[model samples]
Target: MYQLLKQIVTTGIVTEPAPHADSALRQLEQRLSETILKHLGRALAIRHVDAGSCNGCELEIHATNSPYYNLEALGIKFVASPRHADLLLVTGPVSRNMEQALRRTYDATPEPKLVVAIGDCGCTGGVFGESYASCGRVANVIPVDVAVPGCPPPPTAIMQGILTAISARRS
Candidate 1:
């Protein structure tokens, strides 16, 4: 224990320094926060609906909430219920079983709600397309304000999609 303590004291703080912040991201964060506050007068509430995804987009969404992206700090938050949501972030191709639920969630959200469809699956249905078991894209079930297309778009793209949706609503 004494030897371990001595080694620890000798090594002390060997981790690399944190990376510098991206100016573009800072600008986006500022714009998002200001837009939400200006239009909604408070933080933006989002409801995420996973219509039958492979979970890749979900991973990117999770990354946006991490300390690096810090979505909550930008005045964007995920809510458990659609009733409390100002926007819907839907992912994946709509499965037959989830189509009705997605529609219901959209209906439950208050008026002037924005929907940002994430991934190619949610946008054009990706490799899934329209099938008896799958309903194809999210737009086939509910109105979509913005579609961020990528197999699994990066966190920055997802943030941009949200920003676009909110900004469009302002117009």
Candidate 2:
């Protein structure tokens, strides 16, 4: 045990330096925080709805909340109830089963709400447009203020869409 401790003490601290922050990303986050406070007068609360996804977009969405992105630091958070949300982030195509639920959620949201359609499935229904089980795009079901199109958009894209929606609200 003494020899092991001696060996450990002999090895100096060896670790990589912390990664540099992206200036563009920091600017975006700062702008979003300022905009939300200016236009909405409070922190932005979002409700994420998965109509019928293969969980791809959800993964990207989750990444936005990680420490590196720190979405909460910019006064943005996800809520469980639509009633408490200022923005609705919807992903995936509107499936038959989730149509009514999505409508109800939209209806429950307060006035002057922002809705962002995430991913190709949520934007244009991807390859599952207007089918028996899928209802095409999110706009076909509920009005979308911003649409981020990708099979599973990156966290930055999702953040941009949210910012766009907030900007639209300002307008």
User: What would the TM-scores of all predictions be?
Assistant: 0.76, 0.76
Estimate candidate 2's alpha-carbon lDDT, on a 0 to 1 scale.
0.77
Which candidate should be chosen as best, given TM-score against the real structure? 1
Pairing residues by index, what is the TM-score of model 1? Answer: 0.76
Q: Which stretches of candidate 1 lie over 4 Å from their true place?
A: 1-37, 168-171
Q: Which residue pairs in candidate 2 collide?
A: none
Whole-model lDDT, candidate 1? 0.79
lDDT of 2 by residue, 3-45 (tens): 9999878865433222232232211223345455465534789
- For model 1, residues 37-125, the per-residue Cα lDDT tens digits are 46753478999999989999999999888766777766789999999998899999999999889999999999767788999999889
The candidate scoring highest on lDDT is 1
